[model samples]
Target: DIALAFPNQPRAAVGEVVTKAVERSAPTAQCTAVEVWLLAGGVLGMAEEVGAETKDEGPAKKKQKTTTDMTSARLRHIMLKFQDGAPKTPDGKKVRSKAEAETLMRKIMRDLNEEAKELKSKHRGRKPEDYALKSERFTKLCKEHSECPSAQKGGAMCGDLGWVSKDMQSKRGGNFRELVAALRPGDYSDIVTSMEGLHLLQRIA
Candidate 1:
């Protein structure tokens, strides 16, 4: 069993996606169960406080819950771990040992981090001239193809996402948030892929 935390609202949807991805990547027989823990009031400490406070408030008011209070609860994080037998390859062969599994997970995370770094480097290099040229092209594209499908379909359009916060940018798919955050206002990003599709984001303060 793997325990993950999710917002109560989208628990089902997030759980379904996570379960499917894990099952697809590892042998299903070895993976018996996937569980989600709905983290209320941010973190563990906060959750305890909410529970204690609610209990003290008595049963009458508890039944009359408000939407604002419910929506105010947000998921903090999801922790994933292997359960039962070790993960198996697509060919039905199990991973040899715990050490091996951990090693594999570490390597995968490392590679992902490295890829994010490389993407940032490609876009945010030291040379000023190259950066300016890239920004110019990005601006031109935004003007000429404001309604381009690639730019508009999934999330925000290609250019000027408008002073994106670090947290928001990092949440974008493909781990390109580091690249986005590193960019100064008016700096153009190289082509980046996230769940929202391809983006050529330019920071506009």
Candidate 2:
């Protein structure tokens, strides 16, 4: 409205595509609405003032309902175990500090993303080998930089713990399942620390 009010102004150039993420709910589906803050009385007599305090507080409870969302997930990780008495791989990476571990993990991530982009450009469609190629790339990175023995098989692709469940526990002892719960498929967490040292975990499946 401000820009339209001054039609002759040179500052009226606004051309951009913006994408917004909204909650998946009835209002989002049919109402196709977005909420905004209002002034004390009105904005140029646009409408009466409205705020979250006066909005319907009904569905807020529905969000807390329990579910049988227990499902198995697949994950691949590049572990950078610091030499601070954390669990060691067969060939312990002599990372001496959290900073060192994070640096290595970020390097691996950089390499992984570059290769992934190249692969997508090369096979730019829904090909049969899409998942295989992507996961294989992650596997290769796992093989290269990961301190875990799973790196031996390209980030534990064939390891016994293939599709892990929410209730499952790690033999090395950590809230591994909790970590899994924090991610959706194709999402990776920031550097997480436990007795297992610094981790860069991604849920591929």
Candidate 3:
């Protein structure tokens, strides 16, 4: 979340380091320890500089006045549950173990990068109007399948599925088209293969 929050700076670097720290802490250590460390690091890094001319306010006021701006607020909101370390589902089942959680994180990060790559390709060519999975046939297939998650989400695959080409205007040939063409309804493509899963596609009308 911190990496997503600050894509281009020391925060991203620290976030990467902290992610490794969390991984090492698993099994015997709690993820909260990493969260606390990250929070403290962010606070220290974001602290306002104290100068001799601005020494009018007392230390209490200064501490109280240390503010987080919009980006920090968004980061905090997104990471609100990080300290809790992945909550259980509504049915009270544990979402994933610490190791599983780490794996999920890596998978998601890889997928995000793939999606960005496809988008970058689209930016260079003719951009297609973004389409979503809303076809009735697709919905019904998912609804009837107990194994598919889309069945629980009203038969629609999770958002994040979209088409992006290397050349937006010219759909000559690229990874995105090949990817969408490979879908077979309910089955998702290879993990982290495309912007979305490889086969998790629906006909966008």
Candidate 4:
């Protein structure tokens, strides 16, 4: 486990160090997993700053303030992705253009929403086993179509991300975090653009 001080260092840098530490320790310690705990607000503090600034604004500014507020709310979500079909970008990097990524993500969200409705209808009042089966099916669907960064992990499709506090910075990025925070539990969000790609998120609690 790694205990990281809040407002201490960039998350990406910390993650790199953790990855290297694990790799180095693997030879003798056989490290399998690592956990990180943040000590302070870190990026979450930035969100507070935005909120403070909005407090004295006029009505027009209030509208803009609402946007900022939405961006910093806390949330937990299941994130799925739809990768750009193209194999490479103009720079020869293996990434999709923003437009292409958004289009694909929207399509995937539509499909997932329909499936969610069906699952709810079929299992809403059923036995625990029935609900478990529905959950399994949803997991399978996430695994089959998701292109999320963590999707490569076996049996990790649409995996729960746990509770994210408002203004927190996650591996999913700030925009993604804010998007999730804005949604109600059990709600499906529209396409969210992130550095990793485009995402279709479901807030599950």
The top-ranked prediction according to lDDT is 2
Each model's TM-score? 0.27, 0.48, 0.26, 0.45
Residues 13-120, candidate 1: write the lDDT tens digits.
Answer: 243445556658856444444444443321111223343544557544232211121111111111112333656789997645433333333333233223433444
Write candidate 3's Cα lDDT for 1-205 as tens digits: 5443322223233545566777677667755323221111111122223321345753543332222221110000000011126677899977544344334434443343344334435444422223122233334433442233334553344332234332431242224344333322221222112222222222231
Candidate 1 backbone collisions, by pair: none
lDDT values for all models = 0.36, 0.46, 0.32, 0.44
TM accuracy, model 3? 0.26
- Strongest candidate by TM-score: 2
Error of 1 at 184 (Å): 2.4
Error of 1 at 171 (Å): 2.5
Q: Candidate 2 clashing pairs?
A: none
Candidate 2 per-residue C-alpha lDDT over 10-97 given as tens digits, one digit per residue, 9 for 90 to 100: 1111110001112334444543333322122111111122232335663332222111254877766778777645565569754366
lDDT computed for candidate 4: 0.44
Instruction: Give the poorly placed runs of model 2, Cα more than 4 Å off.
Output: 1-70, 84-95, 123-137, 154-160, 169-179
lDDT of 4 by residue, 1-205 (tens): 1222112122323444445566677466654444343322222122233334444663333221222333333222334433556686678977655544444444454455456546656665542223322444446545665665444444423444445555454565736765555454444444555665555555443
